[model samples]
Each structure stands twice: as C-alpha cells, then as structure tokens.
Target: MKTPVKSLISGLAPVLVLAIAALALPAAQAQTAAPAASAAPAGAKKIIRYAFRIAETSFDPAQITDLYSRTVAAGIYDAPYEWSFLAKPMQMRPATAAALPEISDDFKTFTIRIKPGIYFADDPAFKGQKRELTAEDYVYSLKRHYDPRWKSGNLYILENAKILGLSELRKKLIAEKKPFDYDTPVEGLKALDRYTFQIKLAEPAPRFISSNFTDGSFTGALAREVVEFYGDKIGEHPVGTGPYRLAQWKRSSRIVLARNPNFREVYYNETAPEGNARLQAIATKLKGQRLPMVDEVHISIIEENQPRWLAFLNEEHDLMEEMPADFAGSVIPNNQLAPIYAKRGMQMVRYPRADVAVSYFGMENPVVGGYEPHKVALRRAISLAVDVDREIRLVRRGQAIPSQGPIAPETSAYNPKLKTVMSDYSLAQAKALLDLHGYVDKNGDGWRDQPDGSPLVLQYATQPDQQSRQLIEQWNRNMKAINIKIEFSAAKWPENLKSSRAGKLMMWGVGWSGGPDSDTFLALGYGPNKGQANHARFDLPAFNKLYEQQRGMPDGPERFAVMADAARLMVAYMPYKVHVHRIFTDIAQPWVVGYHRNIFVRDFWKYVDVDLEAFSRSKGAAQ
Candidate 1:
C-alpha cells in the first residue's frame, strides 16, 4: 500500500529565517522588479520555500522507514521504477487491470525501461562529482536494505532467499565480520544493461507497481561512489536525484532546500486542458513557464501548535500540513487574514475509504509468537465485547466509522456482503461466550479466570494520546461487565511498533494505507508477517488461498467474489478489531499556492507560484 506523507510542519507561530538569497537581493529590486526577483533565467533558477513537517531522521533510505523520511527521501532519490497514480481511486484491480498502463509490463519478470539523461546528485564530500544513475544503483539500494549491518527496518519488504540470500548472506557476513556489501549479487535484482533494470519477485505481484511508489518500502537507485566515500555522514548529508537537495538543517527549527539546477523535470504530467477554468487560472501564474514552478522551499520546524497556526495566518509559512481542526475552522475565515488566504487555499482529501479509521487489537496467535490461546469463539466474543460504534461516537466525536475488516469501505477490495461482528453493548452475551469457552471466576474475586484460578487479564500498550486513553477507559469499563479487566500502559510509537511486530502487544492503534489495489495491503496475511503480532496473528489457510487468488484475478466479478470472501473470513475471525483509518488532514494559507484537493497530493508544488515578495513587503512594512 502507498505510504502516507509524514511530517506536516505547523504554520502556527514560526520564527522566520530570512533566506541568504532573499536577504542578499535588494529590497526595492525585489518589490518593483518582480520579474527580476522571481524569474529564473533560461538556465538560472528561482527557489520556493515550503514548510515541511519533520526535519528528517535518516538520510539513508535503507535505515529510514517512516513518514518523516519517505517524503523528503523522494526528492533526494530516483527510482528506475515508479508508480503512476491513476485519476480514479480503487481502479488498480489485479490481473484484469494493472497499475497505470504506461508503467513497465511483465515479461516473465518485470523490467523497467529508464528514461535517459537523468543523473544523481553530486556527493558534496566527494569534490562534488556527479555520477550517472544506473540499474546497478537499484541493486545496491536493495542490498542495503537486506544488509544485516545496515539493519534497515524495511528488510522484510524485498526478502528473497534466491536473489538477496538474506538468510545465507547475513550468516556469512556475521562469520566474516565485514561491512555489508551493497553489490551482493542476487537473482531477484538484475541490471539488463545500464538503463534497463529487471526486478524479480518470488511471485507475480499484482500490486508491485503501486508498491514501488512508496518511500522506504521499495528500493531506490543510489550512487555507489557517493555511499562509499561518505559512508559515515551518508545519513547526515544524503545525495540523490531529487528535485531539491538538502541545503541546511537547523534541527527542530528550520531546514533550507535549494533548487537542484540539474534535477530532472517534473516526474508526472498532470496538466489540465487549456479550456478548463482551473487550468487557465493556474496557467496565468506562470508568466515565465519553467517546469517546476516553485524555486526554493524552506521548511521551518515549529512543534508548538499555536505558533505554527499564527505563522500561517500571518503569511510566514506558505503551507501547513496536519493543521489542527479548531484552527482550520475558526481562524482562516477572518477578513484580516484575507490577503494571506487570497494567494493560496486549503483542500480536503481522503483515501478510498471514508469514516473507517483502522485501529489494531492484538490477537494471541502463537505462530509468529503470540501466547494467547487459540479459541475462535473467544476471539468472536472479544469483538462482541468492544462496541466499535460507541467508541467511534465517543472517542472520535463520530468523525470516524466502525470497521470490522482490514479493507476500508472506500476501497474496491472491501466486501460489503461480509457479516459485521457488531457489539451491541451486551455484557451478558460476552459473559455467556466466556462461560461457554470454560472461563469463569470460581473464587469470585470480581474477575473471571481459568478453571485453575489463573487470572485473565489483557495488558495493552497504547501511545500517550487523549484518544487512545479514552478508548482504553471505554474498553476497561465494558470488560468489567464480563468480570475481565485489561491493564493499559502508555508507550511511544517506537516501543509500541516494536512490541506489535514481536507479537508481544495486546492492543494498540495501527494505521495502514489501503491504496487503489487490494493486494498492496495484503501483507497482513503473509506467513512471515504473522506473530510480529501485527495486531492479529491469524493464519487462516482459506484466507491465504483467497488472497493469493485475488492477486492473480482481473478486476471483475470473479475478483470481487474472492476479495469479498476474504473480507468476510477476516471479519468472522475477528483477527484484528478495527475502528478507523486515521486520514491525514492539513490547512494552508490562501497565499500558499499549488495545494491539491486529492488524497494523493503529489506534484502539489509544481504549479504553485507564491508571491513571497508580497510577504517580504508586508514584513518590511510591519517592521
């Protein structure tokens, strides 16, 4: 599935760092000579400052696997392979329909034909020598992910015993005590030539095209020479073939990115027709048509909420993703902020699914390592014990919808015919099921237990958030009715994610992206993914068969039938109890241009032509 863009910078109260380039330009020349100040010569370029959320954790794509790293990494790196986001959501069905038709075709094995003339970013530490990106770069990148020394979080994404030899390679590397080789020859990845790359999957993956677009998950082409010389500072000053290079990072304060003069042109063509009014207005902004409309994107890191909103309103930051709802509704409406809003605007976006925000509840299946007993009826009762509807209304203010299966309703993969395990707030039924499963409190200590007087308690870990706390409280209250108590502990994202992966967690909130394709998010059923708790360690042979079948079937009646069966089986088993899929929300000032109204906000910065000169003048007048 597609990874959501992480790190939305707050626009509240940002302390502006005057760009060196901006400060150097004469004030009068900037205001009166807009063309001179804003325009880029045939070869020269202009820079646009954008507000990015997280500064970034790791520059190394292999080691970095989160929202914060993925979005920024995209610019720095180039993929010989890339996915095309279709205009229609949920159109990426298996067999019958591939991803975008323009993407590489499968010829026994998938191979991507690269567009020529592309080059990687120069290694600043290496005398700024530019290296041509080649198919070998992809091989090196994948090897980095599988390298044990690198310990990349995404190692499992492309594991191949035949190609990567992860099991054998790691074994030998441990014995030899050598640095993980980036060029470890594996059958899964091969360079047809300098420009063509062939990626071999263990099996034909219907969602491979969409999966390639995700950051951190898929391997990106890297310059070998760059990695060799600057192996130590690679994460600090990463090099790639992105539109913008990391110029400066002022940790938790600001990051400045300059235009990559040698960067490739716009990746995708999203041009609207000339007759379209939106296109006409957008076209007029480009007085001097350059491919990438924005020149310099300056990201300021403001963690405090109030300041971020204030900055956006005052026109300090162009755009702010993850804007607080209260600020989005109340502040931007002010006429005093009219001019700031005049230049740019905000957009509402959601994935294929609506209302459903997926929340993961740990299931005790021991295959991966779950210790919980295998009781199908007990799992059903647990689902019956928790009222997802009430939780949605109370905890989420009815902002979300109750979901029973992994596939969100908005996705075409969702099977509506499946029977939902709706908990009707019936504590008696839950107690009856527990009794039927032979669990009761013989000593009457205000808690249920095994026949041998063992206490039945579920210890759940959750993030330190008000919403999570409230959900735990609700679950605790309902569990009391069945004389069962659950212990709640608050942990950070890393710990929760780690424990969940180990299948040691009892319950936690998990958000997954359900892209246009069904198989994209089907990793839940993969054998290796089991026991890493993953909320549910369900090893249903039937579900696995259906999942594998759905991947090969075309997008039609038969595919839908199999997908529906899978969804029904998942809901019936109650492997993971879900509540909602936390959608990404953002608010931007009107002057912050090029914001899209779609779920996938790719190329949002391409057409935006912000009037930074106006903001400069406003600041000058205020001073």
Candidate 2:
C-alpha cells in the first residue's frame, strides 16, 4: 500500500533533494550516447502531453467510476498505498502512510500511522494557514461515503466493508431523519491521535487491504474543510497532497496539472530486479533519478481513432495508447514493430490487460431480464447465438484471448479450464433452444417472435465508436443466424453509463478490471450491487450467498472453489456475454523515457520524463 512507500520517501527526504548520481550501465547493457543537441532541454521546462480516449466527467473520487476519471483523480490524490514502482509480480508499498497497518484482534482491528509535515496544496479552506495532513482527514474522507448525500458509486464497498460501527451509523441517520452528523464520531473509524488512525471491522478480513483499500480511487485522502468550502462544487476544485495539482480544466476539452511546489521530495527507489535483459536496459538509464521529473502535464480527449493516430504520428501527442484495432495488423505486423515507427525510434509496449470486456443483458428488462421458463430459454438461446470466437478473432484483430469467465487472466483465481456456457460457436444448438421455447416467425417476417405472437426485438445501447460498431456487427451477424432482429441505441459513453446504472437500458456492453481480488470479480453479480456494479441487475439469492462466502475467505483452494462455483452460476444465468481479455498497446516517441505499463496503475505521467533536447528537436523539425 502507499504507506510503505510513504515511509521510504519520508526516511529518504535528506538525500532526495540532492542531485541524482548518474546511472551507469556496464558495456553489455549500456545505452548509446544521444545526439548532443537532443540530450537535454535548451532552457525551457519540460511538459508531457497525452490524450484520453474519452473525456472524464468528474474529479471527485467518490463519484468517479469510469477508468478515465479514475486516471484523472489518481494524479490529484494519493492512495494510502501505491503499487511498488518496479517490483515484479506486483507488490504494494505505502504511498502516504507511515508504515503498513498494524493488525490486532485476529485481523478485525487495523491501526495506521502517518508521518508528520505533509501538507495539502494551497487552498483557501486553510484560512491562510498551512493545512497539515493528519489521521483525522482519512477518517472523515472514509465516512463521507455513508453521508447519504454524496451518492457515491463506491458506497456498496464501504457499506459492506464490515466496518464495525459505520454501517450502523448510516442506519441510525436514516431512522432519525437527520442529516449525517459528520461531527458525531463513529467509534469504528476513529483517529486515535493526531497521527494514528484506527479501524475496527466486524470480521477477520486479511485480504481486504489489497482489495478495497488499495483501489486508488477508494483510498485518496480528502479534507473536510475543503469539501465544505466547495460544497456542491467540490469536484470543480480538488486539493490534495499528491505530486500534482489540478491547474486548469475545460470540461470535455482539456485538463492541465502542474507540479505541486509543496510536494514531498522523493526519488525513484524501487525493488531492484535481476536477470531480465529488457528491464536491465531500462534500469541502466533511470535507477537513481528523482521522481516527478516533468514540470506540467496536458491531457486532452480524442475519441476517434484516425485523428488520434495521426496526432501521435505528427509528434503532437507524446504517447499513443491503444493502437486502433483496425490498424493493429498494420502497426505491429506479425507481432513485430513496423519499420516506419522503428526508423523514428518509437517504442511499442504491449501487455495483457487486467480486465475483461463484456456485454450485459438487463436482467430486469422484459425483453431480456426475466425468470420465467420461456424468458430463461430466450436468454440462453441468445447467449449461445453470440459467436464470441469471431469477436476475438476479427474485432480484436487477434490482440486478445477468449475469456473463460469474469475473472481476468491477471488474477490468481482465474481458472483457464472452467467451462463457460455459450462461449463456443453453436448456431444449431441456439436454434434448438429457441425452437423448443416456441420462438418462430408468426407472420413470416423472417425473424423470431415471442411465443405469444409478439415481435421480439432487442434494443441495445452502444457508444458511437468504430470499435463498438465492429463488435455490434459481429453480434448482429451471429443473431442473424437465428433470425433475431436487434437495433442500436447510440449515445456518448457517459450517457450510456448513466442509463445502465439506472437500469434503463435493455442491453449494454462495457469492460471491468477487478485487480488482484476475485471478490470484486464475483461481487458484480451480488444482489445488493444492482444499479451499481450489477449493471445486469441480476439478483439471485443463491449467487449472493456464494459471493459473501468467497468475500469472507482469503485466497486459497477453498476460495477458488467458491469462485469457480460463482463463475459457473453466472455462465448459466447468461446475463453477460464476456468475450475477450485484451492485450492493450501503447507507442511513445523516443523522447519519452522510462515508459512502462503496470497492469494496475494507469496514471504515470510523473514517473516519466521528457528528454527535452530530443523532444525540442522533433517539434522544431515538424514545423
């Protein structure tokens, strides 16, 4: 968690501000000398610019659910613990805490300590005084989720987190018809002192630290006075003790973050790896560098693929994330970097994503969500009708692997051998199921009809993007084989997400990454998650029971058994058609150094530096 890293930085404060010792690589792994003029910036400060595939809607961590917004929030806030920057197998280190939490009472009690002297960015909420960060701030921020007015998307995780008195306090607030008294102390989430915070849970949960608390969005420290100062407009102005501060924001256009002048002095200290030839080369150039090497960050939205690619090619954007599916073949032909980009010294990074992309059928909608025998049959028939193999092969351009279930490949709980129903191509079997349910064309209209002679039409909500269109085309082709007619309801991603969360959409497709925890992967089908994470609104007591069973258990064979059962049940219900696990790619110019992909962390502009000399030359030549 961020706590250990926090301790490391705090301890290393003496040496962090000093000049860095030049990293030296031996003859074998050494980098060649760069063109002298392109080695360092002339006189100007360096700024790193990139693009988000879509615009973020909010900066408030509690309200942000989508990945784009999470990326934005991560830069402005620090999680209690951050993932180890260079640890293989992905380890957690404290980012802002003094140490790893001390657990007592058989894991039910957690006590955390924070180092002193850290301060938030300059804000009027401090009333002309520096607002030193303390343990109480985290307590107030965590309690904000249960205030009932925030309508936090993260409420389920907080409420069900089994925090000893937190849930009871929410119930008390509702019963008394009183607004949540933030002043009234909740014993379960209390600050023991100015620097020590204690949390008591209802049960033993050893892995809860990595699952719920490690979520960068879930653990960012928020100050109460700042919230009160902004009130309804808090999202517009974010103040945190992170490495960067929100400087300028134009909704749907651009966002700029400036390095915090008061940020703690920290250098790059990582667990040294050995024997990996590629990592050795990268380490030779960056081992002792100071962190947050850049001065400012500029992020813009470019929704279309063509313009985004062209901008990267024109040396306008520093990084091109997610090579378009249409161009994957041409860009990285035969799994090799194309000569055109290689000639310019562009670096390509590709790795398996920690998430799975899926399409869900609304379990409450009359056309799809239902429990009757006929309704169940229709859903299963449609699931079988989807040719997921074709989607992975054609739409993904072989950049993905067929999903076994909701659990992603990155998780230890993923079972490659788990049999997923309707995952294979079987049009004949799909037709058989439909025919048995009495689905036939009553008016010779060349499409299936409901048993009661009503037209069965599927209305799906989709984003207006080239990739989504390709996926829809594959789905339509598969449905056509069964003579089922479907239509599209197009909208922006934000609108589609809003409609889905409200249970207004009959069907919609999305992606989710549960990180290292299988509980998150299984909890998507939990009954209480309806209108939140259970986008399908699928509520089965049997499934929720299993979800709880797995949630309480730590990782082991017993937990794996429960996870497998939950996945099997989800496959049987067929609320979602999970097709692929993607291998995302990013191409960065030669001037962008120290670019590496972490499966969990997405916002890493600070960890990267712009080789000013090279970047300046590239820009000048482009003009």
Candidate 3:
C-alpha cells in the first residue's frame, strides 16, 4: 500500500510527476459533514459502492483479461507469493518477509523464498479446517498457464523459446496427460522447501521480477483444490487470499464482495518489517489498530454514461475507474471529487507501463480482400492525411499525448529517431495523393469519385460509448472537409473488436496497450499475430523479424535498438491513423481510502483502509 517514488513522463516532455504523500484528514471530519443517515442498523458493516461501465466478460483469470475483473479478483484469493510495491524494478520484497532465495546475477536461476502462514479461500470440498497455501500450490498455478486445454492468452509469459520443456508440456496436455499434477508435481516449477520455491528458465531475463510476481496482470500462486473444482471457472469464481471474497456475480448486473477478516489482519503490515519490530510500528501508527478499515465492496454495473456520472455525484457509488477524458473539466473541478485532483491522485503511475495512446491504420492488402486493389494508395494517403496533434487538442480536450505511430510513447521499443510519417496536416499533399490514385470530384458534388465515377465512401466502425461516439463523429467531420465521405457506425464494444479483427472494418477507433516488455507490443504487428486480431493485418517482414529478436534479448541498450527498429517500421507505414494517449483517471468518494491504482497491487481494498461506519450509513440510506 506504500507509494513509491514518483515517475516522470517521457517523450514530448520535461514534465516531472511528483510522488504524493497521503492526505492528512481524519475520517470523522468527512463523516460529520455528510447528511444524516435515513435509518441506521446500530453496527452494520461498512459497504463501499463502485461503478464500472462494462460487466466483467468472465471471472476466470485465464479468460478475464480486462481491468474490471482483475481489480475485483485481487481480493478473493491468496497466493503463496506476493509483491511489495515499494521495491524497485527486478526486486519484490516478499509478503511473508522470508529470506529471498538467491538469484544469479544474470537472473537465469532464481532461488525464491516463500513466506509461511498464508491460507486460501475456504471451500468445503477441500476437507480442511483451513487450507494452508504451500510452495507446491504456486508450482501448480504457474504451470496451469501453459496447459493447452486452458489456452490462456497470458501463457505468452512463458511461451518464449527460453522456457525449457514448455513446448513438450503443452503437447502432452493436448494429448490429455494432465501435463502437471496439481496434487503431486508441476513440471517446469519445483518446491525446494515448505516455504521456498525455484524456477529454472532456459535463459536469464532481467525483467522476470516485473513480469511475474509484482505485476498484477501476470502470474501468481493458486490453491490446488480451488483450481481443481473451479478449473477454468476460476476466472469467474476467483478464490484468493486478498482482502475481499466473491459474494455475488449477478451476470450483467453487478459483482459484490465481503471483506475477509483473516486477510485484513495479516496484510495490515505485510509491506513493512515483520515480528516485534512490525507489530510495534503497526500499534504505534494505528493506536492498537486492526486490519481492513472497510467491510465490503459493492460494484454496481453502469453500462451507460449518464448513470455513471450521476451515481458518483449522488454518493451512490464510491469509486469511478477510468473517468471519461472529455468530462474531466466538469468532474475534476467539483469539490466533492477533489481527492482525485490532488498531487497524490493525479500522479501517473506506469508499470512496465507504456502510453495508452496510438493509432491503428487500416493497411489494406489486395492479397487479403482488403480495400479494392486500386485503393491501396488511397488508404496510405488517408493515414498520412491525419493531423494527430490537432486531434489531441480538439477531440481529447488536451488530456492526451499526440501519437505518431503504432508504438505507444515512452515504451522501451518506442523509437524517437524514426522519420515522422505523420507530420503537419497538408491538404495539398492529400489532394495530390488522391489525384495520383485516380480520385477526382468530376461533378463537383463535394465528394471524391473513383476512376469509374463511383463515390469514394467508406464506413468507420467504433464502440457506441459516448466518448467514442463523439470522437468518431468529429473524425467524420474531419474527413468530410476533404470531400471523402465517411459513414460512422456504432456497435457494442465486444462486437466492435470482433468486427475489426475480422477485417470487416475499413477504419475505426483503436488503442494500443501492453506491459513494459516489447513482446507485448509486438503481438499487434507480428505477421501471424496481426492476421489473427490486429485489425489492419499489416504484414511487414522487417517488423516481424525484429519483434521476434527483441523478446529473448536481456533488457539493455541492445534490446532497445531492436525494439526501436520494429517501432520505426510501424511509424513509416502509418498502419492506423495516429491519435492521442489520454491519461486514465479513477475517482472515488471521500471515505474510500486504502486503494492504490498500481497495476501490481491488483486489489485496492487489500490496502484499503476505508471508513466502515460511514460506508454502512451510506448504504443504508441508499436502500
């Protein structure tokens, strides 16, 4: 729960972000300022209400890859291992405070130390008073990612050629050998002791610590019984040792959680020194305090935009994740939402984190049934016609970075020296390209025409969300001024992704996201990966060659060069028209505390120290 040193934003900056100290305010101060409760149950547990736009697609970690479910699941399970956010890159201070296993200087053979006294979610089928988590349980969980039957999209974490025998284990799973035994043995992982584990990688990786233990989106330990019964169902029925437990998942309605007393007490000081030294510090700072300042978290499904904003205003919800950038001026200026505006709140945190802003150009290839063979030049011309900087200033309202290529800003692979493919919006240049491609407005109907005299019109599909709709509408206007008629179609988020990947889309809204590693970004441009989900399906041999080489190289200046080469190819081609990477912000009610937005700290409530008494009163009045 401890905040780390602040990070500075790179690319187009001298911007210095500051690490914010916790706000100095007593719970009583905020509680007393609120309206009187309607009718109070004398000692009801505190309930924190939250709002999310999309219902979790599923709860199984193997399937549920979005931000929503991961945040919720962080609470319900306990891993044999945990990470400390306060530690620097490549180092994860243990949750149990046990001696760290010795790792080689090159990071080839990691000797990990496990902390004792951790337990998984209690289940009747496990046949135990309490299921204690052991090092063996972690071995089972890590191996599960590679199981062919599971087909975890995240298996890429271990899919690299460097993972010895993983390919063989995957083949065995397909043949139904139950590749790794949860009860007996795990093939690639081993338990050296009751509280110690070891993993053998085919090669040294400098970012292993960031890739596995500390990062929230990556692997963590799992309970054997929990995985057996739940199996693939673990996504929805996540059972973890975090601060909260799954109470209800009402499908498209809402997901609920109840605080775990066992975790609250244990994780209270897990980040600090252990034994008497930790106990003394905990007591002195908290004044004989216990764990878990709050009792429950209730996530209300708000698929619509208006409801989400109003719910936060009326205090019906305690938190708002990823506030709409267009509404920032209106929402952040309000006194009730000031907590999000403070230095502590606005400070951007990146984890192997890269900028979220990038553009997806629909690179049409005649070989793949793309735009008409004659329109290839037109597609490339349209890509260059976009004015990304203006798009950021106008559509984004100055909250994002104007992107120039497929690669996100400030990432390890981002190439600063690439020849700018999208510079200066020149209408003359656009007109010349159109003329060369045999486009002309012969009748002067304010619309371009093909050689055979058909109108040059294309449809751009996008999500129906308010922000997206607005951006698309504006983009239509931008293209129209140039006599290129564009039809904007709105579709559901999931369906839109499907349509884009299937190449049913000519052009649409697209964004790039991934961890710090270059491979994460490579998936979008790699020829094979591109054919699958990358909407543009840009098949560049040079780009694919570099992406493969960058993955195995240890983190260093050389790897940077390799990744930069891949990025340069993306910029030069202009596959998708560049846009801006807007900063994502989460807003919450005054009483909702102890939540860190760190991607590594999956469960905000684990560190959550909320005002329970006030939360209970709020919920009672809402009912």
Model 1 scores a TM of 0.77
Q: Which parts of model 3 are misplaced by more than 4 Å?
A: 1-43, 78-91, 96-102, 172-187, 192-194, 264-291, 333-354, 358-380, 406-419, 422-424, 437-459, 499-506, 516-519, 531-536, 594-596, 612-623
For residue 233, model 1's alpha carbon misses the true position, in angstroms, by 4.2
> Quick one: ranking by TM-score, best first?
2, 1, 3
Per-model RMSD to reference: 7.3, 8.4, 8.0
Give each model's whole-structure lDDT. 0.54, 0.76, 0.57
Q: Candidate 1, which ten residues in sequence have the lowest lDDT sum?
A: 90-99
Global CA lDDT computed for model 2: 0.76
Candidate closer to the true structure by lDDT (higher is better), 1 or 3: 3
**Cα lDDT tens digits for candidate 3, 174-247:** 67866554344444468888877777777666666545555333455567677677766666667665666777
Instruction: Write candidate 1's Cα lDDT for 1-623 as tens digits.
Output: 13322222223222232232133234333444344333223543334444544345676787664455555665556554343323333222221112232333432256565556667666565476656666677667767776776666655555511233545676687789976664566566777787666666555555555444343224556676777777767776777776667788776567666666777655333444546565445545553555456666677755445566556545566665655433332333321222223323333332233223344445553211232443555556666787776765555434444565667555556655544664344667777888876778877787777645567776767655444556677878767767776788887555666676677766655555534555545555545555421346666778878877776555778887787777677666666665554433455543454444444323345446555554444445334
Roughly what TM-score does model 2 have, to 2 decimal places?
0.91
Question: Using TM-score as the measure, which candidate wins?
Answer: 2
Task: Give the Å error, residue 364, model 1.
Answer: 4.5
Q: Residue 304 error for model 2, in Å?
A: 0.8
Q: Cα lDDT for residue 249, model 2?
A: 93
Candidate with more favorable, higher lDDT: 2 or 3: 2
